[model samples]
Target chain A: MDRMLSADEIVRGLLAKEFSAAEVFRSSLERVRRMDPALSAMLSVTEEAGMAAARAVDECVARGEDPGPLAGVPVVLKDNMCYRAAPTTCGSRMLERWTPPYDAAVVTALEGAGAVILGKTNMDEFAMGGSTEYSAFGPASNPWDPDRVPGGSSGGSAVAVAAGYVPVALGSDTGGSIRQPASYCGVYGMKPTYGLVSRRGLVAFASSLDQIGPFARTAADLARMLSVIAAPDPGDGTSSRRARPEYGAAVASASLKGRKIAVVRELAGMKASLSPDVEGTLARVLDLCRREGAEIVEVSLPRSLEFGLPCYYILAPAEASSNLARFDGVRYGFSRKERTLKALYERTRGEGFGPEVKRRILTGTYVLSSGYYDAYYLTAQKVRQLMKEEFRKAFASCDLIALPTAPTPAFRKGELVDDPIQMYLADIFTLPVNLAGLPALSLNGGFTADARPLPVGVQLIAPQWGEEGLLSAAAVLERHLGPASVAPMAAVKGGDGR
Target chain B: MTVSERDVRHVAELARLHVEDDEIVGLVGHFTGIMAHFNALARAGEEGRLPLDDLSPVVFAHDEIPPLRADEVVESSVGRAVLDAAPDAREGFFVVPRIMEGDE
Candidate 1:
């Protein structure tokens, strides 16, 4: 019943009869009841559903059949991911009451693996913003400091794991959604290579850039989750049909003995605006890589510096504008009364969508509109190609490119809530990878001097369909740097009565 | 850096969003600020490049198919939760206001 157990440890414990699934479930539920109110990490806790699933897992264990790899392990899913019985709101009022008739492909895989579904975590509205401040429900607080924000749109998933609410959770990364939050919250997050995981039931933000990933306390746990979910789904047209790798076994074999790691020169000093604490932590990570026999090379991605963000904004929104058009009050989601069909479309969308969602939709509409299509949307696509080409060149020289996940540590809630541009700039270092559809991971590099737990995440980027190389590099770094020590907030708050 | 009210209205219409007159001014200011930062993408100098579509996996042509399943089964799994949010629904189907006179 100890909180902060890795998902692998929890599964092993349950299998060995160390604790019943019901006992583990109860402990997680208790943790949520005590901690979630302050953290605001979860949008909805599936108490009844979770207990039911746990009981089923216990029964399977008693029957002497292998349940699954992650059997009996509690995990939180980002609210944007569709779950059969849970309301997948995407942290927006637009789909506040929308419930999918079926589970997302990842959910099916996780459930099939016998993982206990704890709840749906909160996120930015439609996973658009870097911070969860854009979430209609409200921002999730970083576990390290209550006043600071947990970097998001995967903030809730990251916080849930960082706070020990769950050992692992599913999060979707379009533009640094998974990695930024992982860095800010001081945990490991991986955005698998695009097409590696199915996006069938995910509420699409940017179809091309979006990929479901996992947040975990350690690399091994992340590998275990990846192995279960990283498989092609026929339902997802964009999903990869490539052979799946044994991620868990690969993690054990990950070694940097002769690995060529590249540090993108453009991104190295781009975080000049970051606090010195974060800068120093990143420096130490580089030092650790050198000590591990990793040959660090400085590679320049000139096109990436200029084109990545622009291409992302244009392409992502254009796709989003189309994907979101489905929620016009006819098929599903919030509706509004109006006399005319046009009025219904307007009123329903206006009433349902939040300010940020509306803004992006408008931007998207403008870019994709007939007159501006060539000038904005088409031009951005071309830029996206150049960005991808630049990445191709960089990969030829090195196995991975290291960079900071976010420009700074977690800022306080409401700090950039009023200013959308300031919030967007937070993903300066992490967006390009998504734009190029590359595999990237963020691990705990080091902490700041203030003891606020500034997580300096080194992003290891590999070519598309190169998840094996990406996870392997991350595993080496995780072992070399050592596991991050995070004190449970429950003990700090005196709530555990320890 | 000033986003005119007319620009805001035009964009709102294009986006299919209905904004109140009072909210327009505030929204214009927010848009202006966001656009200012978005302009950074322009300076990033990535013009004349190809769009993401060029890199897309090839879509094979499909052969002719037989008659599809009846609509009834397709509509069965859609639950009350999805239907309840619809603006108009009757007899387990989404109902819409008349788009044209004499239209069924």
Candidate 2:
């Protein structure tokens, strides 16, 4: 079995009687067992449950019943996304043993489509940090190089797809968690417009900015998974009531013959100190788009230059502070016995959360506290609104905005762990899209000469509710980029073919 | 301005987190640097605007639920597992320290 096969390939193969769903699943399980030890991508493996589900799919196919769109396809859920049988730890020891009584809305959707649940992938604790280094379980290593960090919070999901462990996996993007890892892992990851996917069972990081998206090797597979998962949910109030479009069909027919693409002029030169490899790859992607008949325009988004991160720091943590307060050891998650109620709450939280999560919670609480609300949280909200308006104007002039996903490629592990500011700055190019609740995608553009596969992703931001257009453009770009080889970790480990 | 250790401790208490005394110094330095980033927002005028306080409502409005028939509501067998994992529990209720005198 090849390390990477698209979801469509797996489904078609299962239907054609070439192999049973159990066989495909065994291969995936074997791959994860071999690769994940080195990659540290998965937090928990649902081997027994996954095999049972795969057998059920095979039985359905045997009876001549259709097993939905993604029938027999195995996918991993980010640990933050709740699954019935899997522990949704959210990469923190606070809820290390917490299991959801019910499946998250996305899990239900994927299950309904006959997708097999592989297991839970790792992430940063409470999705707070940019690198998976903040995970209490331990950092998820980049598939390209074991020594480097996987761009995070959704790093495991990205690495799972990159290493060919799973063709597609679910990831939640709050301030570029999905896109950054996708860029780092050299795969396609999309952060759909906020509220496009339901957030009912997701452990909330930042309620307003968080959205469930998927990572895959191809645009078509991402689109297919998106179509299955993106729909309004009665359980979530913020979920969009808009009708889900045929994303896969849209991708199949996407053409860039007359499309107008814009490169954010301000963001282009903003990271002037980027490594020569990354800069060269980005330039080549621009040239490829121009060659493919896209009319490129230069535009300015000055408001996003400084205000995005500050606004995010205030808004996300403030929301997170409130959302995470429910885990005080009373109703669910970690707890400690104490003589006083206040002490119980304090000790439970202190013992539960990791260092990064605690830092953000404290920052959030401080900003939202009485004396600082007006000076910090309130002002940040206003600036967020301004940034949204600026994006609205920028989109009017161009069909999509393009920029590098990260200022630099994946850095060595522990490189930015000490310097919190440097780590936060890594999301500079990708956060503005989330702040505006716009749909954006990261695709493998080009690579560095070191054969290290420096992934340069051009982000395409569309107006809210314009995921169809954004995806169509991404499909065109993916096709033009050609099929890039994924360097699977299993192969690097010198594992013999199973 | 340098954030004092007192401020860090105060923030940690408000956040409902316990921090060691030695860690307070590092946290103070981190918060001081983070607050400097907030300085940019000071220039933006936000006098009368409300913060995102209304983002989370105490209760969601919904249609009245019909009474469940005994057969319609299946009690989960996993309830035992859940309670078993609880750090503090007594009988069916999650055990908590006595809030009122003589409650225990």
| Candidate 1 ranges beyond 4 A from true positions | A268-271, A490-498, B1-3, B34-87, B101-104
| Model 2, runs deviating above 4 Å | A490-498, B44-85, B102-104
Q: DockQ of every model listed? A: 0.32, 0.28
For model 2 the local lDDT of residue A373 reads 90
Report the poorest 10 consecutive residues by lDDT, candidate 2 chain A: A489-498
Tens digit per residue, CA lDDT, model 1, B1-104: 45688987887887778888887877778767755544555434344233443553212111112233345633446477566656678987789867885322
> Cα lDDT for residue A127, model 2?
90
Against the true structure, whose TM-score is highest? 2
Considering only chain B, report the TM-score of each candidate against the true chain B. Answer: 0.56, 0.58
